[model samples]
Target: MPGLRIGALELSTPIFIAPMVGITDRPFRAFAREMGVGLTCTEMTAAAALVRAPEGVAARLLDLGPEEVPVAAQLVGNDPQVMADAAQICVELGADLVDVNLGCPVPKVVRLGSGAALAREISRTAAVLEAMVRAVDVPVTAKMRTGWDYQSINAPELSRALEDVGVAAVTVHGRTRCQKYTGWADWDEIARVKEAVRQIPVLGSGDVRDTALIEARIRAGAVDGVVVARGMLGDWNFLEQTVSQLRWGEPGPTPDFADRLRLAKRHWDAMVVHHGEQHGVRLSRKFVVWAIKGCDGAARLRARVADLFTQADLDELYQDILHAGEGPTGWHRPNFTSGEG
Candidate 1:
């Protein structure tokens, strides 16, 4: 597949990471960049919080190192002005791009008529996209589901509308809010959305678990790009493998047992540096379980991962994981409920 361009920015490769709530945090993004991810998005930040408590939200969520450049900041909310204000703030804080979340299926977010709810109201979605575009000089993007539900599929129409208002790119997740993460993604609908957009890039996100899936999607012209979400959780080498496959017609080298452990250690250290000792250690637990996936004796190691409370505990657990034999013959894919926001 060819490279992708979103406004003035150009991506040499089309593989990108989704803005997952608990998974795509700062440390993970930085680590992803090191591992060769083309672009990374911060987990969704509430537009209301960015407007009402910019300082706190910035301190807690939007902190970015210089190395994390070319990263997009994703904001979630229904209000046009508020979302715009938050987009501006994200730009001020060094975001290379700002993305609006119109695909989050979480009940709490949908209750406020935001996320996938916005897709149901095209006028409101247009207003929100317009506000965000006008609010910042950087590129503005929107991530949406096919529609609120299968009965109301509307991504093609919505993509055209977003393009009309200067959205730099559109990412369509093949499932609707009502469907949540169940069932196969409708690549046909994703292709329809791509066909609807005239200029801006239209990326696809849903069940992209490996390089072959990515290759198939791009080869089918289903989308201009692919977003890897759950696929990245436990597998640090996934991006490298996908990128190599896309660019050279071959997947990248796989990390052996020691290499995997070393990568996990670096990730743990990064989490601590970015989030601090107590909190970072706690956050590392899920990632640890993910990293240990497919390794031998992982089942035994996972049961003790929850007992981790400090950096030392994490170190000891890694030791235990290392001491345990290599994991299952084929690694298990990390499983998480998929949706944006």
Candidate 2:
């Protein structure tokens, strides 16, 4: 795959890690960068919240570690001026690119006329993105769902409008707002959006789990790139494997049980350092669960995860997880979906 350029920002590859709320924090992004993801985005931040409290919000949601550069800071809101101001804040805080989130399907966001709801209001969404483009010298991009519902699949029209307003690029999640990740993501609709836009790069999202699915979306949708979201949940090596397969036509080195254990430990340590032990240990439970998802006796390990409150708790369970992994080792896709991004 060729590199992707958004405005003056050049990415090494077209593959990007989707900006998932609560899941794509600084530690997670750092690990993704090490794993060879082309671009990493900050988890979605509310424009109004970021503008009202830049320091607090940025610290909580937009904090980028040293390893995380060439990163896109994603903002979500319905207000044009607030979004513009937030874009400026993101740029000030070392964001290489600023992205508007128009694909979030959560009811609160839609109720505020943001996220997927804004995609239905093309002119309004265009106005918001246009202001952001004018506000930041860095690339201004948008990620949106196909439309409000199947009855109104208007990503093509919306993409055209965004491009006309000087938006750098657009990513289309193939599912509609109504779908909310229930069924399959329609790559055909993503291809239609690609056909509609003349200038900016068009990327596709949803249902991109493994190498085969990634290749399928690129070929079938004929998009400029693909965003790996839920697919990267437990499998951080997904991007590395993808780069190897796409660039070299060979699968990259797969992690054995020991390799996984080492990386998982590193990930937990980083999380604790970044988030502090109390919160980090609490937050790391889900990641531990994801890492051990398909291993033997995964249920028992997961049950132990719930009681994890400190490093000692995790240390005690680590041996058990490694012992369980002695039986078999292989990649296991995460069977889940996220409503964010």
Candidate 3:
């Protein structure tokens, strides 16, 4: 695993934490960066929103610690001028790179002709990327699905178009827009895109469930790097595990109950500090589920955590999980390939 260079920034490894809406908030990005992810991105911020209220959006989404540098700001929208302006705002607000979210499959975004919807029209996509690249001094990149649908796979041609417009790199999520993460990501299609773009780096996204899958994808010569999305949920050490395997041929060890609990507590504290207790508790509900997923008595724990509204509530739940034995050994993990994250 060699370092990945996107224009001026150099990543220590090719393992990137994909910009996940609601999930990749500042606290999460900080945690992943501290755990040694190569690159971290902000959750997809709307281009029009940022242009209209740069200060407010920056305060809300662009906030980052000094240690979270080399982070990319991901923006999604259909208007070229608005996208360009948003990219410049992100650059001004300390983004090391600016990434366009052209692969998101959410119906709301697609309905607005953003995200995967952009893939339906090559000319519009090219124009948007060109505008963004020209607007920002920092590296400008795009993340896209293979195409709008299986019937119209155009990643190879799209890759060429993006490269021609001076994109620093592109990430290809192997499924079509129609697939919306239902099936396995096609590494072969990713390889085709890699081959099509001779100059810039091509990254693979989707189905990055474990270190084995990450290694297999890279070893197959399909992508220079990978964007770990849902696979990273509840596992801060996931990137470190992949990097360890790449460097030492061992993924170290699976986090035991105590380690998981400690990390979960840290995440909880950060959320509370970043957003007050009321909202933080609400935001942490899903995180609590992810933290305790596959653990012994997880169902009961989730039920209890759902009604939690304060730090005391969280403490009691943590105590309960600790009292239980380490979760079922060798627990099963779903192959979450959905790019909805």
Candidate 4:
């Protein structure tokens, strides 16, 4: 696969992380960068918040360390002017790129006629994209689903419209909003969307969990890149593993048991540093499970880890779990439901 050049930025490898809600927060992104990922994007922000008041949650979206370059800020809204103004604020805050999200399947966003709902109104979606591009001097890109439903899988047409208006890159998630993560992803459909555009990078995103799936998608030949989402949740070594495979066509060294524990502690410390003692400890509960997941003795830690209220408690629980015995041969993960906020 060839590298993509979006303006002054040149990504040597095209494997990128998909922007997930709580899963792609600041601490998680910092860990991902340590594992050698190329680019990282913040969670979606409300354009209205950025425009009306640039403090609190909006300011949090612009939080970046000096080393975190090429961080793209994603915006979700139906108003072109609001989105345009938000993009300018992000640029001033030092965002390397701006992305418009038309791919989220969550009902809250869709009910508001934003996110995937934009797919239903193609002209309005295009107008928003055109307006945003003109307002920001930085490169603007898009992340879109196949369409609103099976009856209208117009991603190929929409993809072309985005490219024609000077979108720097395009990422197409193969499932329609109606599909809602069910059934197999339409890889061939993504191929068609890539064919519809020229001079812009096209990326395939959906159901990619490992090297085998990534290799098949790359061989599909339409996409210029791949975005791994759920795959990274429990797999901290994702970037290192995928990059090694892409570069040397071989596997990277797996972390030993102790190394996984150390990584988990590092993540816990960062969460505490950012969110403070009480709140950070609660938020990091699930992350502890994900960090130690798949390791030899990880399962023992799941049930009791969430009870901890401080870093010391977390450390003690890790020791207890490590002492519990052989972990499950395989791990069980929960399914995402609409009930979640």
- lDDT of all predictions: 0.85, 0.84, 0.83, 0.76
Clashes of each: 5, 0, 0, 0
Candidate 1 Cα misplacement greater than 4 A, ranges: 54-59, 338-340
**RMSD to truth, every model:** 1.6, 1.8, 1.8, 2.4
Question: Looking at model 4, how many pairs of residues clash?
Answer: 0
**What's the candidate order when arranged by decreasing lDDT?**
1, 2, 3, 4
lDDT tens per residue, model 3, 166-279: 999999989888988787888889999999997798999877877876777677777888998878777767777987776666789988767867887798879878888998
Clashing residue pairs in candidate 1, if any?
294-327, 294-328, 295-327, 296-326, 296-327
Predicted structure 2: lDDT: 0.84
lDDT of 1 by residue, 1-341 (tens): 56778899877789999888887888888887876667899999998987887476665667766777789999999888999888988887789999989998888998899898878899899999998899888999999999988789999999899899999999998998888988878989999998898988889998887797788778777788899887777777888789878888778678787787788789998898778898998888888888788778778888988898888888888887777748558566777765445
Candidate 4: the clashing residue pairs are none
Q: Worst lDDT window (10 residues) for model 1?
A: 332-341
User: How much is 150 displaced in model 1, in angstroms?
Assistant: 1.2
- Report residue 44 deviation for candidate 3 (angstroms): 0.6
In model 3, the worst 10-residue window by lDDT is 330-339
Give the residue spans of candidate 3 off by over 4 A: 329-331, 334-341
lDDT of 4 by residue, 217-291 (tens): 666676777887776665566667886677667657876556656666778888888889888899888777765
Question: 84-202 in candidate 2: lDDT tens per residue?
Answer: 99999988888899988898889988899999888889999999999999998999999999988989999999999999999989999999988898899998899899999997899
